[model samples]
Target: MDGGNNGGRINVAIDGPAGAGKSTVARRVAEQLGYIYIDTGAMYRAVALAANRAGVLPSDADRLAELVKTVDITLEPGADGQIVRLGGENITTDIRSREVTLKVSEIASHEAVRLRLVEMQRKLAEAKGVVMDGRDIGTHVLPGAEVKVFLVASVQVRALRRYQELSEGELVPLEQLEQEIADRDRSDESREFSPLVRAKDAEVLDSTELTIDQVVAHILDLCRTKTAEAK
Candidate 1:
């Protein structure tokens, strides 16, 4: 929502549905380009996880905002990967848990929650040179981002990927994974606040057949070209 100007540093926005490889590809592309990788999804997940810990329901917007102001959401990189901390506690693993995944859509639909987090997201990119990935980054979060990419893949592929990830840790039937993906997609696209959407000018990348390295390479080329033209 912040329409500020960037004096330097190329901004890249990667918007995609769940299981489309946006996080992994964005991180790789950012790393290759020496840009900061901002995982906007993790930001929301952090908030939802925090709310759950504090016994605040998804609809409790008033307490959520209060908690937001008091909570410290910092992005730190380590040997494992980017660590998202809330109130100085490392909840990186907690954010990606099943509970947060089930409730995040409801929390994300709250306008106040979105506004507060959008402000934080804006601050992260205010320095300009960053690659951010999320559902709405290219549309509502960072409309003026220099490079906007909307990645997509078939629903079957997405479901399979999610199943694979969940199956690694625990038992998740394919049918359950498929239903979960459909449910999340519907919620994300139908949310009232900043619903998942592709920006008008965003270039769409269908990764149904493309490998992770291929996707990263393609995005890197587009980012480099766009950054050069902006200068």
Candidate 2:
């Protein structure tokens, strides 16, 4: 992360588990604050997708690390949402597919891959005014962010929210999805390379019974307070 604050811009880091509405909330919060929204999870998914296509297995850490460097993944603002491009090819939707989802955690576990992506992430936040959301945003990516939040929800709530986001045909059984999310939580927390963790200074917000707008509003109020304090 940038070591110096340039001005009034606030770097908001939202970290949490999968299916906890981090991306949606982060985007809304950033839009409301007029800050740049970076979904680092999508960046990992992009690497996963590229590796899957190149006949590379997730265990091939060295190769996967090299592949991601050449892929040149980039995130661009889009009318519908954030557009993720790989090697300059628009693959926003592709990266979100189930295949990539299964590979992302494993791919992200590699130290080299994480280091390379972290460099890119830091560069994006150099000018501040950024709201970056992902598993380790607060703990690892931007530890010094002005505002840090670890958003979470109950397993059932998370599964249902994720279920609602998927199309009818692509939907997985709720029970199975919940189990998978639980398993993912385990993997994320157990991983050796900057495992998913909440920063000591980060405030936790449980969204098990909260609405998206409510979550965004809560974060916004926190951001405004932090911004004022910094000023």
Candidate 3:
């Protein structure tokens, strides 16, 4: 997009914990604004998926870093949403599987892995007009982004959101899902490299009591305001 006459496109950075609706809200906001939506988390998950397939454990940081260098992960805007490709193989669905979910944080926590993917993310946003979302997008991936948002929600609410999205066959117990989400939060917050954190300039948004549409609308409003100010 041409930034609506400002002569420069705005880069939007969105960071949040799992199940805070970062992916969905960022996608819709980008669609409405005619900007590219980059799901940074999926990049890490693609790595995790590859590592899992190769029997590379998360504890093997050196091996995982090597694995990341060997694989080519690409994201393209698809008809439905962003399509994630690893080593030229479409793995949009595989990365979202429960197995990947349990291991992505470990893979993402490695300093080398984060360094490699962060470079890719920066390159993708160099031209601007991109809405990138992930645990550390605002803090590390696109620190100079024009607009930054930190989305949050209560643990209970977050778990429910995830359960609803991933539920199909036999339901996973709500309590179990809650614990899993909680565990992920702990790991994300305590990780040595690029641990989940709110950017100092980011606008904190609590979605605990808000719907997906509500959250997206709020972010769109913020983007509009920021872009208008720039003009």
Candidate 4:
């Protein structure tokens, strides 16, 4: 694993829009590389969860800022994937709920949340053996990362993937899910701070027709190439 990477390892940054399978792909890639997986979106989702439970509106920046400071959000590896903890509670499943998903963008749009979480994310990547996935990671969080992959898929494709992940009781119409994902894409891209633009040097991967294993394999190949170049 230490083959040609600088300082014995490399940082892999993955950025993408909603429901693009970024979290799954990044987690798998991190597992294969023996790297820590940092789900930056989950951090925001944790904030959204905290906000939701606290009755704090996303528009209330000062309140949100105070709320973030008082909460503790952490990501740790689990048997299945990354586990998220908020205030010492296992919120891995909670953060992925549709409510948190819908509010995450709004919470993340606040400069207070982004500034604080981005600092934490940057600190996590400083160790060099981390795979981070989020909208602004490659563009802002880790611009000099050794490897950057921007994953993308059609909105319908992404929405279907998300739909399959949700349990039956939480099901929404596929058409509605598609529209939600599309709206999120526009919101993410048009956000004033750290919008979801692919980094200039990042490799763009369209995984609309690719399996999870196929996408992981392709990213591993890129990791090898970048690590070799780092030598």
Q: For model 4, what is the error of residue 173's alpha carbon versus the real structure, in angstroms, after optimal superposition?
A: 0.5
Candidate 1 vs 4: which has more lDDT: 4
TM-score on alpha carbons, each prediction: 0.93, 0.96, 0.95, 0.96
Q: For candidate 1, give the lDDT.
A: 0.87
Summarize candidate 3's per-residue lDDT along 123-225 as a digit string, tens digits. Answer: 9988888999999988888888989999999999999887887747637888998999999999999999899999999999999998889989998899888
* Tens digits of per-residue lDDT for model 2, 1-231: 233556688899999999999999999999999999999999999989889999899999879878977778889899988999988999998987888887789999999899999999999998999999999888888988999999999998998887888876696898988998998999999999999999999999999989999999999999989888876
Counted clashes in each candidate structure:
0, 0, 0, 0
lDDT, residue 104, model 2: 87
Order of the predicted models by TM-score, top scorer first: 2, 4, 3, 1
Native-to-model Cα distance after best TM-score fit, residue 127 in candidate 2, in Å = 0.6
Please report, as a residue range, the 10-residue window in candidate 3 with the lowest summed lDDT. Answer: 1-10
**lDDT on C-alpha atoms for all candidate structures:** 0.87, 0.91, 0.90, 0.90
lDDT of 3 at 165: 79
Q: After superposition, how far is residue 152 of candidate 1 from its true place, in Å?
A: 0.7
Residue-wise C-alpha lDDT for candidate 4, range 92-135, written one tens digit per residue: 88888888888889889998889989988998887688999999
RMSD of each: 2.8, 1.9, 2.1, 2.0
| lDDT value, residue 57 of candidate 3 | 99
